[model samples]
Target: MWVNCRRYAVQAHNIGCYKTQQRPWVRQLEATYDVIVKECGLFVDQKRPFLGATPDGLVGDDTLVEMKCPYAARDLTPLEGVRKKKKIL
Candidate 1:
């Protein structure tokens, strides 16, 4: 048995794609909710110390924002991509 231990880097173009969409996504959500979205840092799970995540934005006290702006799904809305069976997740 062989395991591939290759490491891959995110391309600059891909990062640009996500950055391009992030602001609009955040703005729309903010306007809809009528609340300010704040930047956050790493949050570790209390039950599992090994588990942690850096969410894209935070809303209020309980809502954690997680944005997925896949470059391939750039043209389609998230719901439309889901309906079309695009691997946006």
Candidate 2:
């Protein structure tokens, strides 16, 4: 008879994978929203240059949306640089 050791580990991994899959749902929702906004006469500006590898987002004559999504359970350290608060020491 043989004993299995990683059964729980494998199950946890599967659950984690399932949780991660929810991320795409959020993305799809955002895309749908942006499209609706653009189609509603937001009029995206196309002449602007992109600065990074990420999507530059929709920029209309009167609107701009620079967006990103982060995992709730993961570190959000990257956001710190986006809006810096000057420390008063």
Candidate 3:
């Protein structure tokens, strides 16, 4: 369990760092969605400090966005495979 948790933490950190590099794309999303994306802070439950969330971006009043910037080759490979299968079918 500890090992899994550590692995998840590292994965989350890597993805978070990658997302920071994709701010332009995120800004485009905000423009397309017509929502002002606000910076998010660590939100902790008063009753349970350990239970907290640091969302990527907050939209307007109630929406939260978690952005993923996947590697282009990895992201396109599955879509290409699906397209090929669709052509066969």
Candidate 4:
């Protein structure tokens, strides 16, 4: 199970077309961004929250770097999915 999960994580990094996965490159990007921050004098918000809008990493106060990965070619967004659910009601 562990091996399978790891493979899936790796695969998530490489989106074929519609699938967008950001976990794989998250660390790399974070590190790069961190170094860029360190050059100045800032840190990331580790304890904030994981709301969809929370940036993957932020620089200072003006920059927000949110990552994304699409699930499929036609998969609706969170809002769209919610709208569809409402229609069912």
Which candidate gets the maximum TM-score versus the true structure?
A: 1
The list of candidate 2 runs beyond 4 A from truth reads 1-31, 34-55, 73-89
Decoy 4 TM-score against native: 0.27
TM-score of each: 0.60, 0.22, 0.58, 0.27
C-alpha lDDT (0 to 100) for residue 53 of candidate 3: 68
Better of 3 and 4 by lDDT: 3
C-alpha local distance difference test of each model: 0.69, 0.36, 0.60, 0.43
Candidate 4, superposed: residue stretches over 4 Å from native: 1-23, 31-52, 71-89
TM-score of model 3 (CA atoms): 0.58
State how far residue 47 of model 2 sits from its true place (Å).
21
Per-residue lDDT tens digits for candidate 4, residues 18-88, read 13444444555556545332122223346863322323455566775545554442477545745766221
Give per-residue lDDT, candidate 1, residue 52. Answer: 61
Per residue, candidate 1 scores C-alpha lDDT tens digits across 21-78 of 6778788778867978898766777999667666778988998888776667878875
1-89, model 2: which lDDT tens digit per residue? 01233333343224554356434533554565554222221222467532212222334565544333334424434345334432110
Better of 2 and 4 by lDDT: 4
Cα lDDT over the full model 1:
0.69
| Residue 9 accuracy (lDDT) in model 1 | 29
**Residue-pair clash count for candidate 1:** 0
**TM-score of model 2 vs. true structure:** 0.22
